[model samples]
Target chain A: MALHYSPVLWNRQKRLYDLTMAGLMALYLIIFCTLQTSLFPPITTETIVIRATSTLAFLMLHVILVIGPLCRLDNRFLPLLYNRRHLGVSMFIVAAVHSVFSVLQFHTRGDVDPLVSLFTSERQYGSFGQFPFQPLGFFALLILFVMAATSHDFWLKNLSPRVWKTLHMSVYLAYALIVMHVALGILQQETSPVYAGLMGVGVLTVSGLHVMAAFIGNRRELHPNAPATDGFVAVCDVNDIADNRAKTLMVNGQNIALFKYDGKLSAVSNLCRHQNGPLGEGKIIDGCITCPWHGYQYLPENGQSPPPFTEKIETYAVRCVGTTVWVNPQPYPPGTPQTPALLKVTTINDEN
Target chain B: MTPPLRRAHRFIWLLLVVALPLGFLATRPTKQSPWLQEPVLPPQSTAMPVLLRTIDADSLVLNLRQSVRGTERQLEILLKQPFETPSAVVCIRQEGSRRAVGLLNAPGLYRFPLPTGTNRPLVEIVDDVHGRTVKTVQL
Candidate 1:
């Protein structure tokens, strides 16, 4: 993915994505400020900036968390997953703004340093309702800063995907810390049920989506069929896949999407290169599998996007006998074109 | 973007644009709210019979108190302790007249005699160093 270690690739898609992200962020801030001023008149500039940046960062974090399981549920969501690191970095910047402003507002001009005062402002560690929440947020911000700084492929390559992914997984811990920070900090002070309810909804939506995706994945894996013979496996009957759609199967420890398109059957790796989106959940459009998340398309025969688009996925050989479709689970090199297995006349006749 | 994802993006934007304003409106502080309102002054005490309020002018503490005698409640004013300055003026407002009562730097309490039948007169503690009323209290 990296030709050289030059900052970013700066492709059209990435540029467009970043532009959209920036627009949304601006919109959110504008709305937040307008409402805050309109309702609570004579608001201080520091308070406005602190609330606006913190809320924007919180919303961005929710979006980032949802993208992962969303990609799992449908490959069409992969486009959002493609450049999610940018969102993370943006979130960290906004959060940093909030952090700096908070320290200046509440902790400065004291006997202690700003950072030191943040922790020492209140000594209610044993009390949950009166806990000193700034420390929790401070630690969470530190984790986000680390993740954002090391989000580039340079770190990914050096750390390896497993290590990189594991490190990034600390986002869950950060999220939990932030939740507690809000719970003990503003929620305790504001005592507004609306704020509490919104936070509850956000937590539920994120957790619910992840649980649902995991459940679906586990259910599919529990299926005892699709036993491999030699290097190939009988995935399903041709009719099991609807026209222009795909049936996902797990074979040889690899997830595969068997597509039935234009009276031909083809197999490709289920994971989309962009975000590991479920390719099988996508539908064929214009003879190319169009992912549901961001509309990234790949031709089934070659597991490659049409020329001018360099994205590709691993392809597999497929065959049909009667109504049964057999797929060679061994994946070919990405973009390798293979002849499609046609549905036999008897299979069509039997269906008719 | 496909129809569904496009719809979702629009929905999210709409929610934030609409819901955020509503949230702010809902949680808006009232004029009477403690955080937004000016802090309440401590209640005047009846147990002491004569309320004494301290006015801090730089490092100096000017104690202003009131006393009831016969038919008149006199305004008593003094520096909590002795000061380096020998002479200072304390102003008392009574019967629509402003009178300057001189105070000595000699330490003990100084009482300001007012016209009989006057009740709860306003006493102003002038700054000994600056020659201006630094604090005002009704006694």
Candidate 2:
């Protein structure tokens, strides 16, 4: 379409550009997986692909979480800010392969239906030699299934962001359970402590970083969430919005993610339509606030996603006076056009 | 979190992570009874309360497949009940070591060969499937 000669154009579209590159990463994965199976015979082809892809997907999603915020922490990192949604969708596909392969591997192994073994496998529950940890992994995989299925924008519109976001939050627990599953079941049974140790380190490091960032950054609720005074109210200091990425406000008792972008800010429902990652935690990538768990992006101005992705969020108007910031509590539909008041940096001449 | 402080906490955290599994390993309970460590159940544990009291040095070497048959059950034989197996020579022990040689005889006895008259130590038939002592024949 059109470029804003304003150097700001780079920041605006860099996310899209970053996303385009991220898409290539998936293609690379597809190629890498294809070549690996071709080179190794005797190793079941589907098993290898599912295993590689599932592992890669899990890793990539974690990277998306880490990278999205890091990119926002610094403007120069904007170039690295890319379409994270593709990364998310692609990871899901690989995870789907892993899930499918696992099911097939566990359910069928010849004429003797293996389904009989899953429950009675003895390894399925705690026994003298068996560890009671299979159900945890099973449950995590099921959670991933739901998160992936409802990742599209259509589901966000139908289910409502509040419900969708809450469901998505379960990913954290799923991840935690997966760790336990590996520890008690796979690591305990398999003699390879090194492999188990490495995997544990990988997951723990990524999770640790997120927790670290959350604590290091603003942990204070600057403005105690004001009871809905009037229809809606400003939730946090304009300085707070500019200082930290976002804050939750009870507007009409509904929590929304107040967004800050390009010296201008907008308030929208905090829940991400894709996987329910925190919209507030998402960085201003490509001039859009993205979901932290899965890279779902929405324009702060109008809540509609950048083209090709149809996700949207409820929109609200944010006004700033001197240093104070106020938010109109009323939320419009995601696709509705919003003419939010833009901030005009102070002019030397206007200064009394 | 400064890098050093963060690292310290992490180091401790990692140490803790390391400590847990090691702790688990240290506290892990295992079936360490030598006599009751074989594939076939060693004669019931002498330590475990058992009714049938029999002490004999009946040792033989034989192929297990052709000897004992039917389900192997952990029976607490009463002192008054008849205690017998398909093979009269059910098990053999090394002279000293509690390690026992368990010969499952489905129907045939002495179906295999052994180092006749030589007892190295002890022979305790340990049920490897479940750490249970089935028969303990002492010389």
Which prediction has the highest DockQ against the true structure?
2
Residues A155-180, candidate 2: write the lDDT tens digits. 65568755665566566566655555
* Candidate 2 chain B superposition, TM-score: 0.29
For model 1, the docking class works out as: incorrect
Which residue pairs clash in candidate 1? A76-A291, A76-A292, A76-A293, A76-A294, A77-A293
Every candidate's lDDT: 0.72, 0.54
DockQ of each: 0.04, 0.05
Interface RMSD of each: 11.4, 9.8
lDDT (10s digit) by residue, model 1, range B36-121? 43232222323224645555554344444446535434444445565554345556677678666554455555555455555555
Give me the iRMSD of candidate 1, please.
Answer: 11.4
Evaluated with TM-score, which candidate comes out highest? 1
What are the per-candidate TM-scores when only chain A is compared?
A: 0.79, 0.57
